[model samples]
Target: MKRYRFEDLPDIIGELLLKMNSIEKLLLENKVNNVVADDDLLTISEAAKLLKLSVATIYTKVCRNEIPANKQGKRLYFYRGELLNWIKSGRIKTITEIQLETETKFNSKNIYK
Candidate 1:
């Protein structure tokens, strides 16, 4: 590290502040982008791509009301959060999880007896 004299301190501090401001701007932009992405409205094709399913399947699911979506006139839109939640809702419990749940239920029943 180069030792800075008192004269150079002001310049060094100014440069640091400029760099910090640039970094702050970049961070804020990134956060805004992430927020927008989370709430983004996705078309049928985009939803299909995100869910790794065919567009036709997405349409069928929408028709059956199995997937969360919004219909605006002739257009169908899905929220990224809703799609992610739908995926999460369909998750199958593991055997261990089921066993633990069963055990908890049985124990609670015994306690109530």
Candidate 2:
């Protein structure tokens, strides 16, 4: 092992602290990135961007209970999965599906005759 003079060790100590501080910063950033990449809840602006709607409109929907979301304290939170599911729930039936349903209804009426 190499030994440093007592006075020289102070400089080494400062450098070590700076390096440790930098490493800690990097670790914190990585943790934040991981949380953001996961299926975490999103803010109103984030939900707006994901849904391609105006923030005002989002607020309105939340007010009238037209959108699926939660209010924690005074802030709103949305799950990306639930937003996608809400979009899916608004899907309109295809022409073929409408036609099939009509036929089934008519056939059922005939059977009852």
Candidate 3:
């Protein structure tokens, strides 16, 4: 195999860092809970975004059994109801849902209602 020049190392490192940063950002923004539980499941990355925390922090909380999580194979999922309950239970201090929006029970049809 051919060796890469020392000058190219910086570019490679920069690209890797950029990719990592993007992944971090994606993990944060994808935490939205607009989808129905029957529609799709939220990943650990999404939970981090929803909670406005880092992915590593999410894993740490999961490992400590502080947050509600479901593990399937190599993937972990967070249910909307369980996550909300976890926040209400005060297990997760950073993840907060706006309770003042409406005082109504959420079914499969309307959550924000």
Measured against the true structure, the TM-scores of the candidates, in listed sequence, are 0.69, 0.60, 0.45
- What would the TM-score be for candidate 2 when compared with the true structure? 0.60
Tens digits of per-residue lDDT, candidate 1, 1-113, equal: 88889999889999999999999999999999988888999999999999999999999998999999999999999999889989999999999999999998999889566
Quantify all predictions' global Cα lDDT against the true fold: 0.94, 0.92, 0.76
- Quote the positional error of residue 65 for candidate 1 in Å: 0.9
Candidate 3: residue 63 lDDT (0-100): 95
Tens digit per residue, CA lDDT, model 2, 20-60: 99999999999888666555699999999999999999999
* lDDT string, candidate 3, 14-100, tens digits: 999999999988876665534455245688888888778899999999999888889999889987667766777874333234442
- Give the Å error, residue 80, model 1: 0.7
Q: RMSD for all candidates, in order, please.
A: 4.7, 15.3, 16.3
Full candidate order by lDDT, most accurate first: 1, 2, 3
**Model 3 misplacement above 4 A:** 1-40, 91-113
Superposed model 1: Cα runs more than 4 Å off: 1-33
